[model samples]
Target: MIKIGDFNKLKVKRKADFGYFLDGKTNNTKDDILLHNRLLGKNNINIGDEVKAFIFKDSEDRIAATLIEPKAKVGEIAMLKVVAHTKIGSFIDIGLPKDILVPFKARTYDLEKGEKYPFYIYVDKSNRLAATTDIDTYLTTDHEYNVGDTVTGVVYGFQTNNSAMIVVNNKYAGVILHNEYFTELKPGQELNLKVIKIYEDGKLGLSPRQNRKEELDVLESSIMSYLEGNDGFMRFNDKSTPEEIYTVFNSSKKNFKRALGVLMKKNLIIQNSEGTYLK
Candidate 1:
């Protein structure tokens, strides 16, 4: 049985000057399938040979089979190798007889051949399967997000402001602000970040810094280790200056004070007019 918009393996029942004819029953009627000559030029296909064909619509609105596989469906991500380039666009070999086009307008920069690029496969207004290099413009979903929401992203490039340009879920390109960056980041790096904001223009904001739970845990652990390693005593008065606290813990004075407060709350230490000491 033949169905529209489906893949089918059919046998070549006959041949003609224009193409080969395939026999298959569709809705209990004998239908003739046209496999164009130009489409089989690369292969030596002959009568009685089984071939795979994708059902496509003809100009007469009839179901026709093509030797070319189906085009990339919407919302599909694929890694394709660059095959050639033209002034208007680059062609990518996406496991199909016909290469997909990546238009110049869809690119952030010029592309070169012999390189592999990950792209979201989409059909353009012209009904052609094309690749997009500028992915940020495509992620325009009405999804609600907020600060401290854990998300994953891939580093794409760097910003002059010291922020890292990242791609999230191949849907959006967002900036991880410099101040929010806590560790080293490089291009192609895949890391987890917290969503700092969802801009009105559909761009996402990310932060590499720890969230509340992680920050608290790190602070507590650092303070406990510092206190235990130092004979259970920390000069927490005027002598433990902000600079000294930062040098010791890589944290601000306020965070040091909060860690001290946690130690006091846990009855692990005591503070006096003289200085903070072990109880």
Candidate 2:
């Protein structure tokens, strides 16, 4: 049986003026997949020769065969680039002459052009190659992965509370909760994250936070450097909003305040309701 969107070892049924037709093994010549000459590369072939081919659909949605290995296959996860975005769906580059469709219904979030995201490739009901961002069904939590382990994840969706839904290493279910919010996040963004907590249901809670003391030191240096560059003073104080502080320092309020307290206790800066000033 010839499975579309996958590799198949098919015997060459016949030679055509344009290309060779690979037997689909369905006993129906009508189902014979085409292996175009341009796709043959450096391989020489003749009638009755068996060749391994990657089967997929062309721009006309007709079944075609290629010896070129695709970036991914059906039932596999791969980071695919969105080459085009349409109201109906997006198209992803699978390293083929024709890109694959990621239908709107197949995605958990709207995909943008030029953005790359991990997608679960599958053959839709129509037997057409398709991609999707909702990879939770393909994810697993049963593994040796543990808390505090450094991992990478791609932002895919958001929760009602503004938490980020993540696919850890494109395999495990993970989330960045609302409390761990930092800089702005968007779909298709790759983040180097840490496994902070594992829930009873086995869902992983992830964080982008670095070591606390080290983070404080970095934030302190960032602030002192900014103050020195900005005439040695800034009108910001501990009462400043986290958003404002983060905009200026790219740090959370907790780290910002801690750095300020450390600086103040050392008499390096003085603060009041109005503002903080370098002393």
Candidate 3:
């Protein structure tokens, strides 16, 4: 019942100059795991002393335990930095001596060295620790989340239709449809998303924007800043295209117009066929 890739509590059977041999619960030294000298961690352990450690295979493929914690364990998600690459896959530094492998097929983009990305760790078919950017298979749609609830998530992949696939709370499946944002989102970007709708299939539809009033507050402030920086006069108006509005404000045309309307109502600005200008 020795579970690799997880923390295990084992008793010391014997000690050696190299390290202590942990009892594998089988009463056999050959079946014992070696807690190497470097992993002793200042503890003067003796036989029959119970110690907790993370069990894994060492460089020699021998069962080993360490007091050091990995950045992420199997069945968990973490942000890891790419340190090196091979023809078959890339390795990420996961706070362990052996970097975890992220195969090319499991990557959303061509991973480059020195770049950090969100990766989900799991045991591969060979029972070796591996990571992947394709995390949908690990995400569940059934969750207790409700509309309007705020949750944290990471962008793992993009749909061909331009939607962003998100894993919410590291477990629930969610997405931000193409119409939700004016800017392009990339993989591995973390977001604090607001749940907009819970689909019939239990999937969540999320948005990055807040409610209308709160959105207007932000947009209004943005407009004021732009006007202030522009000497109180600007040329963009209702005639501006969506792309133009997005380029200037990083917001949708509808939100831009709503912000303009509020400004005009406050008598802070006036608009004509030519453009909008501060009064």
TM-score of each: 0.47, 0.90, 0.89
Off by over 4 Å in 1: 1-148, 230-253, 269-279
Better of 2 and 3 by lDDT: 2
Against the unseen true structure, what C-alpha lDDT does each candidate score? 0.69, 0.88, 0.84
lDDT string for model 3 (157-213, tens) is 888998999888777889999999777787777888999999898999999888899
User: How many pairs of residues collide in each model?
Assistant: 0, 0, 0
Ranking by lDDT: 2, 3, 1
Where does model 3 exceed 4 Å of error? Answer: 25-28, 41-44
Q: List RMSD in Å for every model shown.
A: 9.8, 2.2, 2.3
Q: Which has the better lDDT: candidate 1, or candidate 3?
A: 3
Screening candidate 3 with a backbone cut-off below 3 angstroms (N, C-alpha, C), the clashing residue pairs are none
Candidate 2 residue lDDT tens string, 14-80: 9998899999888678989899998887889999999999999898888999998889999988889
Best by lDDT: 2
* Candidate 1 per-residue C-alpha lDDT over 150-196 given as tens digits, one digit per residue, 9 for 90 to 100: 87887666778888877776556578887665456665467888888
**TM-score attained by model 3:** 0.89
